[model samples]
Target: MSVNPTPLKPSQIPQEAFDWYDAYAHGAMDRRTFMKKLGTLVAVGYSMTALTSALLPNYALAEQVSFNDPEIIASYEEFASPDGHGKGRGYLVKPTKEIAAFPAVLVIHENRGLNPYVKDVARRLAKAGYLAFAPDALFPVGGYPGNDDAGRALQRELDREKIQQDFVAAARHLKAHALSTGKLGAVGFCFGGYMVNYLAAIDSDLLDAGVPFYGTPAAESLRKNIKAPLLVQLGELDERVNASWPEYEQDLKRYKVDYQMHMYKNAHHGFHNDSTSRYDQANADLAWERTLAFFAKHLT
Candidate 1:
């Protein structure tokens, strides 16, 4: 008696090669096992590659010379603190090949610390032909507390004063860098965002433009010293922080600061972060576009 071939489910096909396979094909394990294993490995490898690419999008661009590209070149450097007690460390991203001075952006990382995401952002800025510097605010305090139970523990012990000092020092370092365009701008997310706003208000001479996404400050009086153009991104769905944003915007308007505010509907606090559950791709993309545009218009 002749036996029918065993049918294979569509789910059985590896995701990587599913597009190339015939959906109707059915067979026993022995017939397709080799191909299946190969497909599975390929699928796994591809997934890992894509994930890695997303995390380190700037790797290739960082090392190459691309004037038209927006990926920034990353280099680590140490800056002497203004107080003269210790040295502050920061990562700088700049155009690989450029003759004249280029616009510079100072990026501040979130509470999670100076991770790959921040570096990628600096790379992005460099790719866009801007010199981007991301200083380690938590350096003096011993580094950032990544997102986890341990992170919370570190947050409680973070030294706010030292962070502020480090930020100021980082700005000074960027200004003195030979490749810097001298026209400096600042951008930060979450904790970094808060510091950006604070820095704008405190050190107006160091920045020509500032973009703060979902950052909070201890005092609004800092707004009086702001001398740069500001773009603030807010998420309406962020219940914890949304309440105070109105007041912050009002303060800016009240002070007659050159600023723009954007509120994304249904977005959360960490909407700009693609790696988090709170990430909202649509809003994040929009925010990035707005950020680059703002920097170009103001800094360049």
Candidate 2:
């Protein structure tokens, strides 16, 4: 008989740690307060290093992700956003293997501008057979400051309307790329998820579909204008985001929109990022598989 090993449960960390992380990811808290708050997780039989290392490996382990996938072509590129708010810079990735006009996806980051994790996400999308472009919202003001606090501060300074223009331009650039088919799609998290809804609503002719993870819902006014299908992923433990789902679903139904949504049980916001222990691998894997299937059906 084969034996199944028990799942690893992070017992030492407190739920409060995840709350602090949520606050940080959404730009609602500064690093000093976040760290001071998250530090409490170590009080229950865990060392500060051990628990921090587990909850947030990205802050430290990011350098190790020189994801040199031989099958992927990945690099940074700048594209024109003349009609947009300003020029855009993004981490671009595509499969090196011959592809006749591959489907393209715009990978949007969390509140923090284009960071290493989002770049890696672009590479993963490429490995999965789609062209992925992740734009940095702070490109006009230099770029993403390497530090978290600086990135969050820069995030607040952004003009919401102008930022939308940048994303519209970025998606257009991806769909228009020499190697891309006319089909265009997007996947965004948190801040980016909200962007996906906004962009899809306004550019019904351009955006084909969207997958938004823990992003705030589209307003009722915007729902009527949405042109693409939406695959929404929510974390059951995230009260701030979950509160909008009931009304959002009603709006989707009222508008007769094509959409699908799932709330991962016992999961918190940002569950898909493996760089953190907060990631629920089982749920994230299922969500990712479903997301890929959804994209293949709509984008391809």
**Residue 167 error, candidate 2, Å:** 0.6
Candidate 1 CA-lDDT value: 0.68
User: What's the TM for model 1?
Assistant: 0.73
Colliding pairs, model 2: none
* lDDT (CA) per prediction: 0.68, 0.81
lDDT of 2 by residue, 28-134 (tens): 77678877775665455446665556665465433333568788888888888876655899998888887677899999988778877778778888888998899
Distance from true position, residue 262, model 1, in Å?
A: 0.6
Alpha-carbon runs more than 4 Å astray in model 2: 1-11, 36-46, 57-67
**Tens-digit lDDT track of model 1 for 164-244:** 777888887887788887888889987788888888888768889999988885377677788788898988765555677
| TM-score of candidate 2 versus the correct structure, residues matched by position | 0.89
List where candidate 1 sits over 4 angstroms from the true fold: 1-72, 141-152
Q: What is the lDDT of candidate 2?
A: 0.81
